[model samples]
Target chain A: MLAAARQLLVREGPGAITHQRVAQEAGVGRATAYRHWPQPDQLLLDAMGGADLPLFKDPSAPIRTWLHRQLRQMADELEVRAVAAMALTLAHSALWDPAIAHRQAESVRTIIERILVATRSAVASGELETEISAVDVAAMLVGPIVYRTTMQQGTVADDLIDRLLDSIGTWRD
Target chain B: MLAAARQLLVREGPGAITHQRVAQEAGVGRATAYRHWPQPDQLLLDAMGGADLPLFKDPSAPIRTWLHRQLRQMADELEVRAVAAMALTLAHSALWDPAIAHRQAESVRTIIERILVATRSAVASGELETEISAVDVAAMLVGPIVYRTTMQQGTVADDLIDRLLDSIGTWRD
Candidate 1:
């Protein structure tokens, strides 16, 4: 059922994610689909929630290297149809309702938390320096990738990662 | 009709902006609305296009001060329900269709061009220095505000403007 919902989202937009359509796509009865997920938002959220992309591998690497790899991974994933669809669904729904906003924040917070781990380790090892909170740092680094790819409808050039790292007050030995 | 569409967008999200509803809101005939905007996307686009927020007032200020003011203006405007609604509508539509993507890029480009005007003047006047293009600079400065407000459902702090300016290689005596 979740698979059908995701497929519909990728192929069409959120408007297409109806219980009837999803059940048909899943080869199940509409009643079964509705019984399991009565709310459309719940169905859409569950589908998107289950479709998590793999996070950056090896958070133990040098901070700059790890950031570059992680951002690149994010850039690549945004190009995927399902990922972009899910992101747009969450973004569009989030603004209209506070409940959706909380859910969207939860998803974004998890991603930023992973970044905090890398930055904390880097700061501890004297490999990076910054006064801003980890959230702000994540916003500075990851925000551009989101802006360039999702907002501007453009790809993240490899050099962009370098420029971003340079601009963010990283330290050298 | 555009006013009606804008009202619907702000109050009820994109789902509420239909010919029948907008015509009713505008106190016009449904046929008139349909004649003017046969397609829903066209109506949404026209309504959003007409709802442009005022850009930064003075572009002649020093680059850092100019960026700070401009970003603060943007942060404040995004808090406006209509502005955020239009932005989310464009963003959600852009991903599903390339035609919508082109339209979205045009709107975003105009805003970026204004930023470029400031940065170009600053570069010529020696008030600021950067090797990156104006687009990347705008992304670095403005992107965090968007990420903070729309993506994270948070407000932009004044210090964030200072941090962004400091990080972006601005020069000072």
Candidate 2:
């Protein structure tokens, strides 16, 4: 049922993930699909949350390097034409759905926390010489990538990643 | 006429700046408004392009400081419920309009050029130590503000601005 819903979502976006369509896609009965997932939005969110996505790999790398990789990975996903469109739709819709809004905020907070952790490590290692807070560094690292992806409609390039990394790495105390 | 159009735009958003309303607001006849500016979009663009608006302020401070101030100004504007809605509507509409798209791109480029000029002066004065390209630095500076405004719907506070300046300033070498 989940697989059917995922196929429907990937093909027709969040709007087309109905129980009937999922059952048709999965070659199962509509009742079966409905029994498994009650709401289409809930099904879509579950599928997205259940995906076996990549984890943060280099947790100990320099803050800049780690951030660049994370951002590039995120941008790569966001740059996918269908995914990008769906994500934007979801973001806009999140304004009305308290559950979705909370989930979205939590997702963003998780990413920020990861970067904060990395920054703390870097600071402990004496690699990043600065008086800046970890939270501020995390925000700066995530800000540009989110800006480019959401507004510019494309993936941030490797050169941009390098520039961002270099900019953060060289911060003076 | 342009002043009245801008008042409607900044106060009520893009949808409210119709020929009839603009004419009414300007105390001019509907026929005269249409005869002078056939397309409402063009009128809004013209108003945005006008010199009297506070959107384009000349900064006398150093590049980083000036950039921060400019971003803060934009943040303040974004905090305004009406102007933020209008600016966002305009940005999304630019995706479909070639002329508006060009203007939006140019607006970003112009802001970047201002930062580049400042960075060049800093390099010449031995204040900056790095050889980072001005364009890249400009992106780093502007990207966060744009992201905060568009995605987070939040203001780029003084602390974030200061952290951005500190991070980028250290990239001199």
Candidate 3:
């Protein structure tokens, strides 16, 4: 049932995730699906949390390489139209639903923590801008990709990572 | 009817702007509203296109000042919760609906053209990186504020403009 929910979410955006629709897609009874998830939002939260999109892997790796890899992974993920639309759907849903917002915030906080871990040694060594916060760094790195993929519906260019890094004035190689 | 639709959209997100709800909000007969807009997407597209939220004004102004002013204005606008939610709603809707995507693409193209005009002299004079596209520059400049305001539900700090400019390596002042 959860897999069905995730498939519906990724394929058709959040609007298609009602108990009846999910049950139909999962080949289960409507009453069974409703009993499992009284609210569609709860079903959505679980499906999103369990969706197998990996990001920011190996946070302990060198900062620059780790950052580059993450950006590349994001670009690859967003290249799929379904995945990109799902992201935008989740972002939009997060606005009106506190539960979605909280879940998203938890995931974002985890990613921010990973970014901070990678940047800690660089900041201590004066290699990164000391005044900038981890949140700012995340925004700087991830924001453009989000804008390009979700807003502009454009591909994340190869030069974009270098450009973002250059703009941040960090980890030049 | 359009005014009521805009209000419903800005106040409660896209899901609230059905013909029935909009007719009630506008104190008109539902039949009249349906006659005018047979499809809800038309109403949404019209409302979004006619929204009075100003952005990228005075594009002929000097590049640096104009860019900073635009960013500041965006921060101010997104500071309003409803406005930010509307933006997310539109972004999400644009994915599923081709009409919304077309309207949004027109506006985005206009903004990108404005950015290109502002950067033309700088790019020619080598004051800015010649290799970067205006769309990339726009993404780099605007992405962080969108991230902070919509995704993070955080305020755009005064220092963010400088940090973004620094990241783009254009217009340090």
Candidate 4:
């Protein structure tokens, strides 16, 4: 039911989502849909959070290699265009809603934390030369990817990611 | 007149931008407003292009310094909360409107070109390494600023921009 709601929301938009429509799409009774998710926002939020997506891999991979792979996977799965559109929509909406703003803030923090953990592992093994803080490195990694995806209207191709890895890899001590 | 339209659009949203309201706000006759800008979209586009504002600065400063200043100005002007809201609304609207999408694409491309020109000048002066393309460096400079403003709802503080400059400065051949 939640998945059905998400599909409708993503395909049609937030305005088209409702208990009746979700019930019709999911092949469930209106009463059942209403009982499960009284509000469309709740349903959409659950769908976003409830998906059983793949988790980040072992910290053993080289930091740059791992980051490139992860970013590629995310770009592929989310479809760069869809992610770009959704991100822009959410950004505007976040202004009016404190809850949405908090969620976006938390998500960015998590992405930064994951990058930090990988950087720390690399530092421990003496793979990197610069003793830069994890937060700073995370921002660097994020900058290009977001810029390419959002502003360029295209995915970060593997070749570009490779170039990024190569450039940053040289900083390794 | 353009400034008044923009203020109305920003404060009241795209829907409230009627010729009568804009004329009233700008202290012009409705006939005069219609005569000047026959289409509402044209008026909005002109305002967004900074047509009425003296915002453009001479590119006389060093590229790095100029970029830092521009990013700082964007952060201060947009404000973290306002940027998030604007990004979200624009993102959602663009998905449905081909015209808006095209404008956004062009806007980003123009900004990237401006950055590229600045970076190329720096490279010519032997201040920056020639190995990294100006396009990639421009992406690096803009990506984080947008991400912080739109997703994290945080200011792109001077310290952050300084950190980026410091990192890129180390990439000498």
Note the residue pairs that clash in candidate 3.
A167-B167
lDDT of 2 at A78: 58
Query: What class would a CAPRI assessor give candidate 3's docking?
Result: medium
Q: Per-residue alpha-carbon lDDT of model 4 for A29-64, expressed as tens digits?
A: 999987997754465555554333332345555666
- For every candidate, the chain B TM-score is 0.67, 0.67, 0.67, 0.66
Model 1 C-alpha RMSD to native? 7.8
Ranked by TM-score, the better of candidates 2 and 3 is: 3
Top candidate, metric TM-score:
3
1 or 2, greater by lDDT = 1
DockQ for all models, in order? 0.43, 0.29, 0.57, 0.44
Put down candidate 2 lDDT per residue, B80-157, tens digits, no spaces. 544454455456555457776677666666666666777767667666655656555666676677656655556667
lDDT of 2 by residue, A125-171 (tens): 77676555545555566667655664554467887776666555543
Enumerate clash totals for all models, in the order shown: 0, 4, 1, 7
Task: Return whichever of 1 and 4 wins on TM-score.
Answer: 1
lDDT of 2 at B18: 71
Candidate 3 structure lDDT: 0.74
Candidate order by TM-score, decreasing, is 3, 1, 4, 2
Best by the DockQ measure:
3
Alpha-carbon lDDT of model 4: 0.62
- Every model's Cα RMSD, please? 7.8, 7.1, 7.2, 7.4
* List of clashing residue pairs for candidate 2: B129-B172, B129-B173, B130-B172, B130-B173
